[model samples]
Target: MQITKLELHTSCLQQQRKFYHEVLELPIVEENQNSFTVKTGTTALVFSQAPNTSSNPFYHFAFNIPHNQFAAAKAWLASRTMVINTNGKEDYHFEAWNAHAFYFLDPQQNIVEFIARHNLSNESNAPFSSESILSVSEIGLPVRSVSTTCEYLKQNLSINTWQSYEDVFAAMGDENGLFILNYIERPWIPIAATPGIFPTTISLVGDFTEFTLEDAMYKIVPTAK
Candidate 1:
């Protein structure tokens, strides 16, 4: 599945606009006083300013990059901002998954990642830029029950877990797009932040069907040709 758009909340909109537009160099597609949308390659990230009474829970998400541009992408990011290191390692290679990734934090302290799935055929010789970003492919969804959430997604959306441990974590969907479901209080990898459930909405492409995971209440809207 391809994530066409994702709507998330943030406590500070101005800072987010600067981080995404100036630092990441993602073009703004739309903007208003309360919210704005930026183009992350094929995906549109919409950030809404949260209310004062609400807690703006941070998130973890990944962007797909051309496998061939992994090194260049890392260098490009490092030159612009600090690349996060986990256990003194900045880059990570998952041999079983045939993927390489690096992480960083956004203005909202959200864990952001650029993941290259070598198993896929995405390759490029051109210099890596914001254009090299394929899409917002993975989103961390904190749930109370990993198994129940995975089962709901499998039955309702026809998506299965790509990787998981019964009570801990589950990566659902294919390499192109995934929902990282984890039990609350579990710390996100490469960082020490505890996972928390927040309002989120995702739009998927290829099949025009939509559903919402009641437990997490994440709306999944699909679009088709």
Candidate 2:
């Protein structure tokens, strides 16, 4: 699956905007008083100010980087922001996924990732930069029951599980894009903090129809080709 756009809520709209537009050097394609859209390669990432609530909403999402640019991308991001350390390690090698990834937290403490899938043929000879980001590769979907959610998506969308599935976690879609279904209260990958499963809107190129998830916290829309 290929994610074309993702809409997420943010308590710190201006700060998040500056982080993406200035710190990461992504181009802002649209903006307003309440929200702004930034183009991260092919995916349009939209962040709108969330309504007042007791707790601030955050999320976990990832960008696909060139297979051969992991080191450069890590260095580039580390220089701009602090790369999250996992068990004293800054980068990780996922043997099962055949990918290397690093994590960071945005101003709102949203977990962000830059992942390089070695299995893909998207190696580049050019220097690594913000422009080298290919697309939005992953978005975390925290659910009460991973198995139930996985079944629902498979039945409704005709999407297959990427690799494996367990009671607590399952990855839906292909390497180009994925919906990471994680059990609620489960800490996100490479991080031990409480998970953030805020309201999200995902637009993608896929085979299924558009529908809202259980609690209306998520809206998945498949665009026409």
- What overall lDDT, based on C-alpha atoms, would model 2 receive against the true structure? 0.90
lDDT of 1 by residue, 176-195 (tens): 99999988878998887888
lDDT of 1: 0.88
Clashing pairs in 2: none
Q: After superposition, how far is residue 193 of candidate 2 from its true place, in Å?
A: 1.5
lDDT of 1 at 156: 71
Q: Give me the runs in candidate 2 sitting further than 4 Å from their true place.
A: none
Q: What lDDT tens digits, residue by residue, belong to model 2 across residues 115-225?
A: 999999999999888899999999999889888888898898888998655688889999999999888878886778777668899998867778888588899998764
Give me the candidate number with maximum lDDT. Answer: 2
RMSD of 1: 1.6
